[model samples]
Target: MENTEFRVELVRLVDESYPVVVGRDLEGSVAEFLADKHPDRRAAVITDSNVASLAAEGLLSSFGSRPADLVVFPAGEASKTREVKERVEDELIARGFGRDTVIVALGGGVVTDLAGFVAATFTRGVPYVSLTTTLLGAADAAIGGKTAVDTPAATNLIGAFHQPAAVFIDLDRWLTLSDRQIREGLGETVKHACIADAVFFEALEDAFVERGLSPAEFVRDDALAELTARRNCEIKRDFVTSDVHEGNRRMGLNLGHTIGRALETAAGYTLNHGECVAIGLALQSRLGERLGYCSPSDVARIEALLRAIGLPTKIPEEVPVDRIMEAMAHDKKGKAGAIRFVFQDGVGRLVVHDGGSYARPVAAEDVHAFLQSQV
Candidate 1:
């Protein structure tokens, strides 16, 4: 996309009272956006070591007159935990971070989630801005007010709904991703398309033809990718707007996240979240097809898109289907011994399983069948 022509509007959710600014290279513009609200002489940035060298310099440079401190954590999903969150909090406190101080997160989903949680808890909530560096972070994780860290028992069971003051997405950072990383991010985008827009889904099919292209290459000429991101953001924004606390509407965004989270935990936090979601989405689609909620063609298209993006459409070979099902039973969405799921009736239409009304409750047999079909 031509840098001059590409424009990302600032979306402000009145309910959450947070503004989302989307644009290429918006990371460089963070200082200006937070200048008025942040009069504190010093700010602390929490980011992973992997991204610190790449993103930290530009962000620090943007601070200019304002002093910025850097706290670097080890990269990967495993780093998102209570221990990590406490360490970050201590760093913030040692730096004399007052209520006026801002916490800037510069990395992928894990960084944003951990740092944002720390920001929320520190001094009973200080302002923070999400400078997302990955596709999943940009399109989903960073937008919503959800911030969390994992526990030994479950993923994201410990967290808070803390909205950032602003979100800055730099499309330029995406250029640094490997093919595998890009494909992982595409999983979230695909989920958004499947749940919200059919056109966006088709657009992703075209972009992933050659194992994903650079942001500039794809976003510049491919209007669809840009549109898909925007549309996906809108879907999430509306959901959060209605249920900022994830009381109702926000549950829709958890379409495949229930099973996805379980898979991540089962993998001992070794798998990327988007990769797990890709598998979860496929499993859900297969279940939907078997239950007659979605057609076989729809399931095929979903799996094909995931594969084209280099995502694993099936569960990992190491994980047993029964274990995955057992984990699913403990999902956050499950209620009163019944597991609930968000299944699609068709493109852009989702129905939450409500105590086996029209939708039959998926049993262990069905899950095993779905798993077998995928392998």
Candidate 2:
């Protein structure tokens, strides 16, 4: 038998921060954590239809109590809404669950977000654990503890900051994801390296672009997957812990999200989050070129890596440029009449303005022109 446990990372906050165990074959360790930490608490596992039959089933069986499972909401970004959340909460109530329940979020980012939200409010706050099975969740979403569901007006409009008791990045399950899923998750992986960890960024380029290894191949290599996932969490933790609740400090983490999220909304969610972020990253690099934040070579290198990883570096023709512009104005980070973009200085570097803000206000007209030029 292989002993699979490895290093653990901590978020470290003002009040309390929890440990994130990063490794492969984490099912046994996850079960042990809940058993020792929660004792008699019932785990009301939450996941979506896509994941209910996957890791969720095994995770539930691992529970010492063999605790009852949870409802399988329809999967996809569409399910990340208030209506689905209301129904999940209702189902838990009907099952007689209470404050003693422990939320086991056993899927990708969607499950992590929706389930964590349920924990934040159910009985006014119950402990939760994230067995993040997807590469996206493992690299980014599952670590932050920011929980929310979307509304028609915008994404994640209603949410709370409820950190999990523990987080497990189960790399064993990540192997089950498709090649496209692997590429999508690398959007965050690349984003993590772009903002911090220059060495990690170069390594990604060398492996996926220069040497021509595919995203799927990279993730399948245990050594590569473990190091990449671990680095992503560390970069995220560095920013999140310093500004847990609200501070301009953590805004740097939004590197490509500002435009990426807007494009996602404009595209009507047809494009997955990671795909949209890849485009946003390319666009930001272009903007950097125009603004002298980065050179033409920098833009080329960034776009080449994104393309090599099987991600989109250009805005799709089907997604109207004007709609993307409109969505930006409504971005949650937008101030007054301007959108503050987290621009890049170059590959592996983000721009921080003289005012000490990671994102700076860009003229909407300039952004409009940039969109026009791209199309």
Candidate 3:
């Protein structure tokens, strides 16, 4: 059978343009692409424990020659740390791998982020490619070159901006994901639509809200998968092309990520990243309503779509509101010593603050009050 593919060219803020390829059963195509692109560079596969078996073989095959090594770490958000990063670097060094190695992140978001950071500092910088395995990675994590590890303080407080030479989001790899995982990815999907493409937002409403289908019911729906993969990369491309380092307009991509990261970090990652963002998407839309940037119905529609897709639209009781606030204080998005957030202007567009930044600073006390009310 012939393979169908969706390609988005990402012209990053630095260096040459990179291609993001989205397709199902893409191992063969990926091999040819990577071999052509980096023929002389040695290859290294950096992944996690759970994804090592699933990712190594195909990725090693992409190099045309045997890879230098497979660097696997523990497979969860917890492993997204400086320590794990050090270990990965140490292994690569001990194996004689160096600056000429093109790191292949062959797992989910964690691998992409951690390995990209490793690439950023390894011999001052080396190139990497993303073989993103999970739907969440395909939706939000794999693109944009925003790679980082978490500290006790905040999510992504310690990281770097290092673009990959290319990205491959293989839909076939995501078939192993559970239903909740699919919903988590959809949360980001809905977020991308909410911020840039009103038509995409309406398409999501039609599929998940009006039709009322579980994300799993359409798990094998290739057309929907292709649409989602392409749109995710394309929407992100708009931001990275302009602000690769996230200096200005790129903050628009954080519409649901502000409160989402704080809560997830505070919750000690007990919550899935996508689910927390779903809650944040709902909360921020409501905050937008409070500021008159959007209508109440707009907020309701956002929450309804999230709920219809089986994502959590409310904060869990166990995660303290105060802790979430504390984490937000440490967020990388802070400006003027105030916590700024990216809020939506109705369903499909983001609000640009009067201060010239795409995000605005709402009083911390106000955010606390609103969060307390949600409990």
User: TM-scores across all candidates?
Assistant: 0.85, 0.91, 0.88
Writing each residue's lDDT as its tens digit, candidate 2 over 46-132 gives 888888877766776666455766768988988998889899999999998987898888888889999899899999999999888
Q: State residue 196's C-alpha deviation in candidate 2, in Å.
A: 0.8
Please provide, for model 1 over 113-209, each residue's C-alpha lDDT reduced to its tens digit, 9 standing for 90 to 100: 9999988888888778888888778778877788999998866889998889887777777778776676677778888887777877777777765
Which residue pairs clash within candidate 2? none
Ten contiguous residues minimizing lDDT sum, candidate 2 = 60-69
Report the C-alpha displacement of residue 140, candidate 2, in angstroms. Answer: 2.2
Clash number by candidate, in order: 1, 0, 0
| Tens digits of per-residue lDDT for model 3, 70-89 | 88899998999999999999
Q: What is the lDDT of residue 275 in candidate 2?
A: 94
As a TM-score, model 3 comes out at 0.88
Residue 129 local lDDT, model 3 = 87
